[model samples]
Target: MSTYRLFDRRFIRHLAVLVSATVLCFSAAAQNVLRVATEGTYPPWSFKDAQGQLQGWDVDIANAICEKLKMKCEIAAQDWDGIIPGLLAQKYDAIVASMAITEERKKRVDFTNKYKSTISRFVAHKGTSPDVSPGALKGKTIGVQRGSIQAGYLTANYKDSDVKFYDTPQAAELDLVAGRVDYILGNMVTYYVGFMKRPEAKDFEFIGPNLQGGLLGDGNGIAVRKNSPELLAKLNGALAAIMADGTYDRITAKYFPFKLM
Candidate 1:
């Protein structure tokens, strides 16, 4: 072969290999990663550990789902108020933030069947005894996480009460410990396992009946963008696979003493 033609062929071959590798890398990146968002402030459900790594039931479950789907999972913390918006904006592919499904939220997103069902409860300072009757609680200040289902329920039902909103349930619980709010309602498992078990929260106790159903929400599920039905179906299948293969129970027992499903 002539030197010029030989060099030209080698260059073309090298260029073709480079382009092929680049295309494979891009394809693998696009097809292999699953991005998940969680509220790191919500402990036992999802939270950062001492090392700032995301850990908790929701985190574990999300990992299991990704494993079952054979996807590389990336979990990031997002503020609770913006979790839904974050998914819609494509900041992440899904939310495993213990987001309870509600009709209003359904308009904006799709959800998998619940991974864990939780009861809601109202907490108050132990030293304080207040009537939990609707009329009595209506007159007392209530604390709630802003933008939560509990907040919506409280607002709709307790129109006469002073509602103090916090960015996180932990923050609201702190205010209750400080006597800032008469009572606060939230996920029972969150308060029972994450809050009431803490030494600082020794003065707090669950009051009122266990709350759920209606506007308070039935259970927590994974949230995906409304437009992403294929992704949603993949998540749902992965969720089911985890449930049937005993991975779900193993993860639940690692976090909670009781059955969560």
Candidate 2:
């Protein structure tokens, strides 16, 4: 072979290798389709609609963030009890299920910056005593969803109260409305939609100050497996962009009664 032809052939092979490596990197990034886990039962954050389709603020936010990052986002339903375990096992890439960013949770998984704020609030019969404080539930049966922030708050604060934990907020709300429980504590937005604003909720009213900055943590955010900073950074970038462009506020206002931005 001619020396010139040999040189040309070597050049072509080098170019092919470089192009292959570049494509591999991009494929790795593009194939970064994030699998997000959510409590299939949390409403206003995530829940099944009348048609059995998953719908809620968290759903909307997930789709929007996926769109921004050009990721093939799959929102999967996992029980709240198993959500953290699922993420740890790589069953899902992240969680955007309105989970509070508590310090204890921080010890387990890395969370992005706060995307939404929530406070634990309680609902009691309309004519319930105004003096009922978080501490006043002592000996009284208070309802909370199992494995939730509200439960943690009650367990921590009202140790004397008989904490009745339910699997879902809807169940707790039902018992509360039926007078089976003294009160129910959960996310204000969920309580508002699932019980407070309902016709039957006319018999119930929200009580006490909004609980936050403590056991409730500093609001809700997306969570990823510990050490997944690359993925976390990507989500943070998309979230920051959306907030800066007012997309987050628009979504929040559409579903929430007040500004959750």
Candidate 3:
């Protein structure tokens, strides 16, 4: 070939190699397995079953969403205390565990449009003089799960009250049953699964208006890395599709008495 023709052919070959590399990079990204982190102790959101298998609303929903995305999903159980930091460190692709979207957390991560709403509920002893009213528990101590919406709510709204933070609802419930705390504060769904379902739960009752919106967050959404714009877009779109098709409502109904999604 002529010298000019040889130069053009080499340029075309180099360009082709560049294009192939780009395509391969894109394909690798598309096929990446999504890692979802959650606090497995939170019932109705994500909790271990009696057999020690991970089962709950968030688990089911995550599987469905992954199915829709046609991507493999790996659910990892992380301590609630470290969930946020772990996500920030890129330990997971998203947190599907009933994590609310809050301004404080938005600084560290992005969230999908809220797919569900949960009210913080208070469980108190039946016929107890002090009920679950926010004001009633002012002097009385209340047990709440640490690093949860219940603890956040109590700290923000009932600063004057004695708020006892426990590591988990199970621990908080023990204190509540032992009369160490007058009441227990947590999400309604968690209360239902962990406490309300127990035979001994008959001694307790849920009370107070559903605390909604604002500092509690617009509701629960999928949490993602702050810079994961493409992943966030894909997840948000998947959520929108599920919500629009009533799949979200169906899943909600299966696990909750009321429509949380």
Q: Model 1 compared with the native: what TM-score?
A: 0.88
- Ranking 1 against 2 by TM-score, winner: 1
2 or 3: which has the higher lDDT?
2
Worst 10 residues of 2 by lDDT: 129-138
lDDT tens readout by residue for model 2, 1-261: 999999999999999999999999987975668788888787778888788888888888998899899888888889988999999998989998999989989999999999988877878877777666646666788999998888888888887888899989989988987889998888887887667778888878988777787888898989999988788899999999889998898898888768874
The residue-by-residue lDDT of candidate 3 on 1-261, one tens digit each, is 799999999999999999999999987985667889878987777888788888888988888889889888899888998999998887888999999887887888899888888777778887766445557667888888888866787888887689999888899998888889888878877787668889878789887667767777778889988788888999988888888898888888887777775
Model 1 misplaced stretches (Cα beyond 4 Å): 1-27, 127-131
Among these predicted structures, which one has the highest TM-score?
Answer: 1
Of 1 and 3, which scores higher on lDDT? 1
On residues 1-261, what C-alpha lDDT tens digit does candidate 1 reach at each position? 899999999999999999999999997897789899999988888888899899988899889988988898999999988989898889999999888888889999989888778688888877655467668876789999999999998989888889999999988888888888889889988887888888988777888777788897778889998878898889889988988999999998898898976
> Model 2: what TM-score?
0.87
- Please give each candidate's TM-score: 0.88, 0.87, 0.84
lDDT of 2 at 145: 90
- Provide backbone clash counts, one per model: 0, 0, 0
What does the lDDT read for residue 78 in candidate 2? 92
Q: Which candidate gets the maximum lDDT versus the true structure?
A: 1
Clashing pairs in 1: none
